[model samples]
Target: MSSTLYAAGRAARQSGDLQGLIDAVPYARFLGIRSAAPESSALLQLPFREGLVGNPALPAIHGGVTAAFMENAALLCLLLRLDVLRMPKSVDFAIDYLRSGRPLTLYADAEISRVGSRVAHVSVRCWQDQVQQPIALARGHFLLEPAPESA
Candidate 1:
């Protein structure tokens, strides 16, 4: 994992806003992310396949895909808090890889650092089998402007 994955997190730490980076999620995943408690943490699991693989020889999961997993996991915090009724959009996100993700099911964890009036922030971490070591980390920000009520 490259150290850059922690980019937003590091910045947020400096700015005292770890929650924004903790909330971004990818555009993939057939099943949405989940949380044990409304305020605990967001968790996501994605199975590896050629669809997620960029190169067949390396069989390494694409960095973008890994980022996506993190993003989905991070954004899940708000969804859980909102009870899946409100849909949040991905305004921006940042990822830092700690190492290369191997071919396997990935588990992602995210913590909400802050959920302000208009912005929800989160931090995400990814790992395969070992929870002790993280393969990548990410930070994301989501805008919470409600959409118009269509008749």
Candidate 2:
């Protein structure tokens, strides 16, 4: 609950400006994902754009694409938490595909579960326009390294 929003310029050294986020948004958009504002607590939303559709011959979005969105959301959460400061690395991630992400903007919300001294645990829930019904869930372990002692 001690989350704080960082403006475009003030965004954690990691999350860049809207334009930058927008430019970098490709990182998400490429995966069909985009992070929300109010950095304190954010969500990643991805539209079911035509180009991103896989096997349009089929009714469901590609599982790989959806999973990519989940990864972006979880990682961005860690970036926001560090005030864009520390650069943490993902040690491992576990994802559960609950349902198909269809006909809507897929989203992922990162929840801080625990912050140990060396690792931070984050939980992400992905839903397609509806928070109640989620398409997937993910949990990640990020390894944190302290900043080098400055002179």
Candidate 3:
């Protein structure tokens, strides 16, 4: 599975196919995750679906779903931006729920703070209508496997 994903990642990177990369991940497809503007930025988007509602009364998105979306944003950013050959593994993730996620399309952007030899630190913010009013924020570390040098 990892090898397949690695090959897909390499293919996507070589062709600059952001949607293809998202399609390579089953879970991302299940969540309706897509690139907001792959040609410009690493912004990720999740279309609102009835199944995504956690609170029917309040019509709010599930917390777990929101977290997973943000995590995916970070992971996608790493895959799109870095020279990684193997899949990036989450080391630690911390999220702050600023507000309940409304039953609307969610947008997320991940910024890589630093990249060490083995780990990369990333921060992500999820919002609905307004970017200034974020619904959730997260910071995480991912274990990276750099591509081996050519002889």
Best by lDDT: 3
Residue-level lDDT tens digits of model 3 in 1-151: 6666666677667776677777777888889998787563678899999999999999899999999999999988888778777679999999999999998999999999999999999999999999999999999999999876750
List the RMSD of every prediction in angstroms: 11.4, 5.5, 1.8
Q: TM-score each candidate.
A: 0.66, 0.74, 0.91
- Cα lDDT tens digits, model 1, 51-136, are 77776788788888888678767655555443222456688898889988888888887787887777888888899889788889
Error of 2 at 43 (Å): 1.4
> Of the pair 1 and 2, which is ahead by TM-score?
2
Clashing residue pairs for model 3: none
Residues 14-93 of candidate 2: C-alpha lDDT, one tens digit per residue: 44433234334346545645546543456667776765566666667788877777777776666555533344578898
Of 1 and 3, the candidate ahead on lDDT is 3
Question: lDDT score of model 3?
Answer: 0.87
In terms of TM-score, the best-performing candidate is 3
In candidate 2, list every pair of residues with a backbone clash: 12-83, 12-84, 13-84
lDDT of 3 at 146: 85
Assess candidate 1 and give its TM-score to the true structure: 0.66
